[model samples]
Target chain A: MNKPASLVVLDLAILIDMYGDDSADTICPALSRFRSEASKYINQLQHAVVQQDHAEIARLTHSLKSMAGLIGACQLMEWSQLVEQAAKQRDQTMLANHLPELTTIWAALQTELASSLLLYGSADA
Target chain B: MTLTRNIHVLVVDDVILMCDFLYGVVNKVAGCRAIKALDGKAAAEYLGNERIDLLITDIEMKAPSGLELAQRVRSGMFSQTPYDIPIIIFSGNAYREVIEQSIAFDVNDFLVKPITSAGLTAKIQYHLQHKKVLKPMSHYAQLVADVDYAKAIELPTEDRAFSVAIVRELPEPKADDVDQREAASKAKEKKEKKEFLVWPEHATTGYFQLDRRMRNFAFNVSCFHNVFVENCKPVAIESERKRACEAADYLFHISKNIKQKDNRRDFWLLFQQRLDKLQPHVKELNSINIKHHSQVLVLLKRLAYWWMQTCSRPLIQINEVTHETADE
Candidate 1:
């Protein structure tokens, strides 16, 4: 039988360390909430980018950066920081260029986080 | 049998994930009860009504920034919690400006973000075990008021002296001009009202009554400095110096009135010694000649700087008291 795929984008170790060994109960629900919040922020970022509302873009990206950092999504956090800086500086071209890649990373992170939750959830059972 | 009380810590962040993560960490610690607030406004509500022993907050948020919340707490704006409750401000950046601002606002401690479980737990434990020495509310409030007055009276930097003199020398206005000026001044005052209080480190004495008196002294000294620099009449300069001397005398009287015991007694003794050193300068100010304006200014500046340093120094030395004793 083939082994399950390991998480690449999301670091579950940090959460495990924080919540301790039997953190499945804590981790699963927190990840689910994070996934939902990330989706809403992504939608808002897209709208802000389309409208070229730099302030809203900055604010959303900043929140996303902090949230991503909390869950050990380093790449997502870095991308969010870059996007936030661009938005703050009113660098329309940079934001337009980098936002798509940021979204791609978020999508990847969501999948990884979901799989990790499932793995931990089943193991706990 | 020994009794134990649950340590209630208030964790505030705008992000739900961050708040939950902090809550998890705090909940893991034995004898700790973690209460989470999603934003500063929520935190304020909790602080106003709940029994929060410690506050851990993020600096950046949607509104009422963590620093503002700290200011409100330190100023005794909340009804339930003690004004001097330990506040730990955490931020992703930990930049110089933020650190300086946190110190100015009198937060107990600061932490940078991406905190590990061990690091945060240790910080929470440390703050829980130790309480900070704080000025009485009356003193802190007066320091805030003095800083506000100082900021308001400060002249703009570009040709400040000339501009101030121009404004001061303006002839009496017509009745119509008076109404127009009053409208403009009111609008300016409204705009200048700050969202939060910032106590300058130099102005804080860490004692309620002493800080108030010392700030009054500084304000008078500042007035003297302004008039001296502007080459005002000798009479005006003398009047300002007299006011400053009167402030210094008040400081002396208030210092005697402070009733202290234990560690507070030690702080009071140190303040009295510093006051002894300061008295000579205040006396010198009274005798200094107006023609020797530079000498007078030097004395005023020295006393002001000395007063700030004395007040800013730590009053209570934290003993290595064990957590067990702290709980009792």
Candidate 2:
């Protein structure tokens, strides 16, 4: 089995290399912010989609995309980009279709990243 | 005065979460204290009373906006102290006009939001240590012009946008002409797509000077890839190990370069995170003495594609030309 072929969950090694023993100290707050902020935006996004508020949806997802990308949530970032573009273009159908997937992806990301953060925190401690 | 004691950062954002995030990020740096302002008016009020070493404000805030805050500080309208205060406009919008306006207002840097802690800290520290004296907007304009001009000069007249004349009349339609036009259109479309794959303008750090310093980095990655291919050594052999060692050297060189540029340390750190993801694959490829190392090659190729996509093909192509010209 090629170990290289698997998707990387978190590049904790790089973070540790960068921040040294302070890796968790730096990343934990950012990830914590991501958790709270992402949840708020996802709720806003869903409401915006229901109201067909394309501009508001675009604005909300744009921040979500940046935050997701910052935390190395690749799939979430990619999905946010699509939703942002669709919202910008006022494509209701596309936004409706992808919003659910984005929600699902965020759930998976939360679980995966929580464990990743724990690993870093424990290592640092 | 000690660096940390003197350094005061004002973090302005309409969203309380973002303000908290920036405050958290700033306090991480040694000798830095971050004060949060919820909107433009609050930030303006802070400027009136307190001495802020660095100002990081979001651009899209309502009523007296970040732009307004920047203008007020520059003009010394709010404060008694009259000097250039390092202000960084961190916003989600990369609208060209807004950027131009921000630069005109003498905003030190325009960092796109959703910025990592590292990227944000780098700009903050850089601006805090070395306050900008030059007109940032002009530097940005010239940077864009220089990039465009360099692209034009290096391309053939047929390929240059300046040489493309507007034709009002179509020659009498013919089958051969139709096929030729269609082929040209297809080729043009492909080129346009490639051109669009550049570093986002909104994410520009207001420092074009770093590009010159980083030129070597762009070359080193390319050179490592080329050397590996040219040698044509078997993957399981000693030569393969040598190549892995050489790749590691390039990685180390980049790490050192990032370290030396203290102001840009966080920015480079963000990029390093992405590079780190590719490292394990390289390590795996190096350790395994076997055939079917195609995955490693593919990963390297993908990394190269991402580098080009991020740094931009035009800049890389121009660097290649300069290198070739120098070699000659």
Candidate 3:
């Protein structure tokens, strides 16, 4: 897997760290939200990969890569690019090892995001 | 007057991310609400239903570029159609072609992009203030002896905001030739009408001295404001250097007289009351000035902390600017 550029797809890592969710606790909710969104896209990406749809995989991975940068998701930020590179080269071995770990981090991020959203939802409402 | 309450801002950009960023920033401004459009075509569709007070559209886009949108907007051929709307083209390029296009399309203004939140807000404030001045010129029709030129500037068909160009009072000659031999009344109108003559803000900085050379009083004040921005501070002026300096020099003389008589209290009182508000040069710069030392300002802490936080980052760095430009 080729190492991806830090900010090609998901930019604004700087801005999110600076400004996203100024009202939330540490702006981690934004980070969590990014993780959940990536999970949904990556889930679709897995389906595309199994069906040999490289184009869809590229598009989904590219978007998730960008989103990772936006939310400053460190591991996914690194891994999403590798996923994109593996998909590009049709390296199923590299893609398979990274997908489960990416999915796991993404799941943990969703639970955290949902909990944070619930907390803010009541507080803001 | 403008519906000085919430002026609806329509932010058009091709990038979804940029559009969302502007919407957040605009919504935070007092007396403003924002809607987003992903591209110029999306903007045209949104305009059909929305009565937007201002349009902040980006220049580069996938379809119906911002300039094309501005042209269609000026022509009144688009769908929530109003008579004339204020538009600011947000481009990375604010060069000759973009500026001339804005002028030909009758855009209220132009701003260069990659601007920070503060820079973006400044242009917004300027156009909005320009609209305010013109919109109320109607009620001052009494000043026009009730020959309402209100329609000349225009009232937005839906809301009452006036177009910025009409709001900016043009300095046309009062039917008098530039001769010392002009009739008494004609000469008097010239004295009162001096400031309207001005170098367009887009003019090259080189042409600035020409206004001073001509001794055009109102144009001089405009020049003074621009000069301060260019030179970085107020300059010491010579007595009777040019006709433009006449009104200001006379005031300076009066101020000197007050100083010689030990009237510091009265002089500063007059300064706050009658001077800077009317003077082209204003001392109160940047609701967000970082170079000065003051405790009352918000956002200073954030700026102060940026250096400490970003010191370890590989690609970014922050530093304080020692010199400051004057507010134009």
Single-chain TM-score of chain A, each candidate: 0.82, 0.78, 0.65
Where is model 1 more than 4 Å wrong at Cα?
A: A1-8, A18-22, A122-125, B1-3, B142-328
DockQ of each: 0.12, 0.13, 0.02
Question: Could you tell me the lDDT of residue B245 within candidate 3?
Answer: 44
Put down candidate 2 lDDT per residue, A1-125, tens digits, no spaces: 00111223334333333233346666776577677788998888888878888778867876775566456565565566667656665667866777777656777778876886686663421
Q: By TM-score, is 1 or 2 better?
A: 2
Q: Ten consecutive residues with minimal summed lDDT in candidate 2 chain B?
A: B319-328
Report, in order, each candidate's fnat.
0.29, 0.13, 0.00
Question: What is the Å distance of residue A31 in model 3 from its true position?
Answer: 6.1
Give RMSD (Å) of candidate 1 vs. truth: 22.3
Q: Model 2, range B268-319, lDDT digits (tens) per residue?
A: 4334544554466556645644444564455444444334323321111111
Q: How is the predicted docking of candidate 2 categorized under the CAPRI scheme?
A: incorrect
* lDDT: worst 10-residue window of model 3 chain B: B309-318
Q: Where does candidate 3 clash, by residue pair?
A: A9-A66, A10-A66, B47-B80, B48-B80, B195-B218, B215-B244
Clashes of 1: 0
List of chain B TM-scores, one per candidate: 0.44, 0.46, 0.41
Interface root-mean-square deviation, each candidate: 18.0, 10.5, 17.0
